[model samples]
Target: MSDTVDETASGAATDPVLQRLSTLDRFLPIWIGVAMAVGLLLGRLVDGLDDALAAVEVGSVSLPIAIGLLIMMYPVLARVRYDELGHVTSDTRMLGASILLNWVLGPALMFALAWLLLPDLPEYRTGLIIVGLARCIAMVLIWNDLACGDREAAAILVAINAVFQILAFAFLGYFYLQVLPGWLGLEQTALDVSVWGIAKSVLVFLGIPLLAGFLTRTLGERARGRDWYESTFLPRIGPAALYGLLFTIVLLFALQGDTITSQPLDVARIAVPLLAYFVLMWGGAMLLTRALGFDYPRATAVSFTAAGNNFELAIAVAIGVFGVTSGQALAGVVGPLIEVPALVGLVYVSLWARRFFRDAPSTDPAVPDTGATR
Candidate 1:
């Protein structure tokens, strides 16, 4: 059986799949909107708030954002059954497809779209390419879990991407930004990025939360037993994922609120390609995985993983390599702005599409059923 994410609690009142969502999950779009507005307002109104948050002393990582991301990711990671991770690791089809989607098709698609859509905007184009290179390591888990995806599979895929990012990000950045463009007879931009710099992002953003979650799960299960850990501890910690997500959204946008608010036109321009990329990547991943005969949970997990980008890493790389005020940074900032709402909407889309999977599990939280790896 597949050890997928158990999103809803037992005895949930809402019977329908969508209605089974808690109030927080139910109104996620609204909360995300409110968070975005509040962040933008804070950045615009408050003096030096953006600068202060941006100046955190975590080296490549921002402390405030780190806090929220760690909080956001820990619960989902903790929810993973490490013992069952073996099941996911053995699924060569999912693993191979994840690598192809995240590393190969994902970056190549972004390069084409960036060149095709924003030819004149070099900085933003470069920024979008960087976003595509940095695969989802932080927020994809939340989206996957919320969509009722395979928990262990998502965790395994995320970890693999993190390791791959550390190794390939700099090389890919150089190739795409300079080598590929030159080969294509387009304007080539050189990126002076270090492998360590990208590796630091992986360590801080993903490594910390991953370690914490592993420890929490190992300890919690050992001390409390699996039944107690699953039923009691997991339910309590599960809600923290959304809380961290909302908190991170607020800070992420707040740090760039002034930029987002003042430059509406540029934000919109950067957003167009980003919105398209998210939808296309997600939809394409879902379709490809489904065609491979994956069940809903596994397909959903892979789709979310492939579709999401590591905005945190992208923004950091852009700002660090291209300067904070560069157009690249702005493009990176605009990524989550488009991605948050888009992915949230896609969650509902995934739920709706579950009807097509004959082996789909009972999405209604009112009924308790575990799914198997198909």
Candidate 2:
């Protein structure tokens, strides 16, 4: 079992598509920084462009960003094998732990960190809470695969998070941003958040892509066969999400370039809690996996999934609930900039941690050892 898993993972790691993706992930921070610089430069050179883009809004959501959001989310949602979600019931303990970590403990931790770290910066705090509320759905798969984690388990978790986000994100956003701050006696600005508005944003951002992805995969596979869809079709379109991500970042920073440049400290302030949140969540989840006696692959999957946030959804909702030029949106823009490098570093840490559990037995029969000591 372990050898078969090792062979499969090794083959995947060497595949051309994954290699291209790995190369992209390796220089992700550089790409983001370049995007920021380009956006700032454009913002300075073309004074009217930002205004023009900002003007194209419907119900607070920027049209260009909305398009980018849909493009970014579709590839991710399309890649998810929703049928595998049934496997979640077979591993109830892991599923329960993941849910607890992602929805409950994860959000609570970010709320505490945002408050503890940014007492005065209400907008930035709200941004952190928004990120916390939106759990991982897309990027965790890449992180998990890199760490030799159980891909099936990762897929199940991704599906679960996606469904949960559609259901709970708005209410949690309201609770944490509106009610909790008041209850905790923290000074908060009057955030005009409507549950219906948030629900609409989720539906537009996640729900539509989800439906489209489901239909695309179901129809495409039925027509062309699963092998061709997985190998040929998926690789061709998978990079669309990353492209959309970079475009969104450029547009976001282009819109808010002046604010970011003038108040550099504010960017740093938002980054601090975000950095802390990633490390804490990764560490906490790693320890939890160890406590649960999961093997290295399963442990890495749980830890990476818990550590990474669904920044795409967070950014969309931030722009929708707040405005494109709002400070909350700026903070949302800053999240992926901080997260990619941090999580990549944690990927290396996970590799090292794998050595410690290399000989440990897997609690779940579904996960094989994988001999993943690369």
Please write out the lDDT profile of model 1 over residues 46-115, one tens digit for every residue.
Answer: 9999889978746466789889998898888887888878878999999999999999999999999999
Most lDDT-accurate candidate: 1
RMSD of 2: 5.7
What TM-score would candidate 1 get against the native? 0.92
Residue range 1-374, candidate 2, lDDT tens digits: 12122323465446322232245654666776788688877766777877877788643556787787677767666765667656645887788889989999999999999889988877888888888987877556656755557766786676678778767876787788778778878665444445565456556665677789889889989999887876667667767766776787677667667766777788899999999999999999988988887777667777888888977667767776688677788888788768876887786677556645644344332222212211
| Residue pairs in clash, model 1 | 1-372, 2-371, 2-372, 2-373
Which stretches of model 1 miss by more than 4 angstroms? 1-15, 360-374
TM-score of 2: 0.76
Q: What lDDT would candidate 2 get against the real structure?
A: 0.71
Clashes per prediction?
4, 0
Q: Ten-residue segment with the worst summed lDDT in candidate 2?
A: 365-374
- lDDT for model 1: 0.85
